[model samples]
Target: MTMEFGPDDQIDYDGPVTPYRQLAEILRARIARGDWAPNRAIPSEARLVQEYGPARTTVRRAIKVLVEEGVLFVVPQRGTFVAERSSEDR
Candidate 1:
């Protein structure tokens, strides 16, 4: 928990989607597969930046989309967490 992304966040950037959107999709799939449990902390902005090579705003946009889509929840002083059983994801 050094507040860094490292190699794990690095992405190949495939397809027509923006890097942030692609990152969102990647996180979404992981959540759907139980890679991240509900209420668990998702990756941080610094990590995402290093991994996706995108601006903070772009990453925020992608995350915002997920929040709007009901795939994530933000807890004060904590962090973003995967929503359990989001209907939008189904």
Candidate 2:
């Protein structure tokens, strides 16, 4: 059960983990690796679906997890952005 992730990691559909969880881990790694700066918007849901070959629902679910974990935030029509680090995260 290796759950570790890092920048440049790709989703392995053959692995034990579900695709949505893999996507969440990948997104987390991307954020930690500075793929997108805090408060910067990541790619849109449609783009993510096209890039990762996941269903839109799966992508949304992964984004929801990051949002709940404070790693990302959504601005309705604007799109999802990386969250500002709290004092604790710093």
Candidate 3:
């Protein structure tokens, strides 16, 4: 499947990219496009699962990837937020 997401909300279940990876890419793009501002929460894991139809583990994995890449940070019970603005985003 030669699929490429183009700033869209739908996830291609039959595409080559795994659901978790696709979700990660989608979120990174969203952040870059300023859909959610720095230090602001994006969406809850349950919300993501409902929106993207992925498993909780998949959503968590995608979140983990972003956290590792410094695009997002978790605040215990509060939830996940976009990373603080940084020169790296420049």
Candidate 4:
């Protein structure tokens, strides 16, 4: 289920897939492509909103999905970041 998405990919708001899930896939693609390095913080929610034209809640939902999949993690006050992958994961 690996989809190739580029950095300039735009969201299909009217498509069958939910906006949040589309965003999650886009972010996952970016991470897989090394747009964000391991342990590096992703852009803030506000930035994602600006870039993706999704509401804050939508962005949060996307991030939550990534976190649940172990693709990302969050710090209490810092920010969300790309999770470090172990050898087994690679």
Candidate maximizing lDDT? 2
| Cα lDDT computed for each candidate against the true fold | 0.72, 0.91, 0.88, 0.91
lDDT of 1 by residue, 50-72 (tens): 76687888788888988998889
Clash tally, candidates in order: 1, 0, 0, 0
Where is model 3 poorest over a 10-residue stretch in terms of lDDT? 1-10
In model 3, the clashing pairs are none
As a TM-score, model 1 comes out at 0.71
Reference-based lDDT, residue 27, model 1: 70
Report the number of the highest-TM-score candidate: 2
For residue 19, what is the lDDT in candidate 1?
64
Which ten contiguous residues of candidate 4 have the minimum total lDDT? Answer: 1-10
TM-score of 4: 0.90
Instruction: List residue ranges in candidate 3 displaced over 4 A.
Output: 1-4
What lDDT score is found at residue 53 in candidate 4? 98
What TM-score does each of the candidates earn? 0.71, 0.92, 0.88, 0.90
Structure candidate 2, residue pairs in collision: none
lDDT per residue as tens, model 3, 10-68: 77788778888889988988888889999899899999999889999999999999999
Residue range 6-88, candidate 2, lDDT tens digits:
65777788989888889999998899889999999999999999888999999999999999999999999999999999998
